[model samples]
Target: MSGVFQRISSIWREFCKRRAYGALIHPDGIAAQAEELARLADLALRSTAALSALECRHLAQLAQSMRQLRETAHSPEFCRLSADRRLALHRQLLTAREKLLASLQKTQISTEKLQ
Candidate 1:
């Protein structure tokens, strides 16, 4: 009976250790991810050949949002965020990427229009 109990306890401890390790997010990782997103947004803005007034405005807004996100990720407060909050921030980043892509797709000007 004692041996069985010890084995179960050891397994449970290992599982808990793995779970805790998986939950941690290094601050630098978050900062790097945010920077990459910002870079992509900036590249999209510069690479687009012809953006209408509305598209320009939308792109500007997206760029601002990306800047804010990057700033937030680098802040000390961000480092203190709970694991769940960090996860939520990661989800928000994904959503931001999708929005950026959608905005780019919508603003694509046909070559025929340019000519």
Candidate 2:
């Protein structure tokens, strides 16, 4: 009986975690992320004269990924993902955004140095 209770408690905790994760990756959250990414990309492009070939390629790839993310966020399939899976997707999006921004910042600083 005690073991059964423990198992039930564990399951409940897992369910709650999933729900929280789902909320984090909800459409609204994705939309907000997409908007931020677009803003960042625009800023990077505005400084194209300071960017290297590699930086430009990275920005281009980032733009493509952002477009895909926007499309996925609007798709019915994305809406149906399990909360656990949604959390994973959210993390990936965040990581990608961070990397892109960091790369752009590094390029910007390097360009400024040449001035």
lDDT of each: 0.69, 0.74
What tens digits encode model 1's per-residue C-alpha lDDT throughout 1-115?
9999999987787556446744335566566667777787777778786776776677677677767766776688876666666666667777877887787687653454544
Kindly give the stretch of ten consecutive residues in candidate 2 with the minimal lDDT sum: 106-115
Error of 2 at 1 (Å): 18
> Model 1 lDDT vs. the true structure?
0.69
Residue 98 CA displacement from its true place in model 1, Å: 2.7
The TM-scores of all predictions, comma-separated, are 0.59, 0.67
Worst lDDT run of 10 residues, candidate 1, spans: 17-26
Model 1 ranges with Cα > 4 A deviation = 1-24, 102-115
What residue pairs clash in candidate 2, if any at all? Answer: none
Candidate of highest lDDT: 2
Cα lDDT of model 2 overall?
0.74
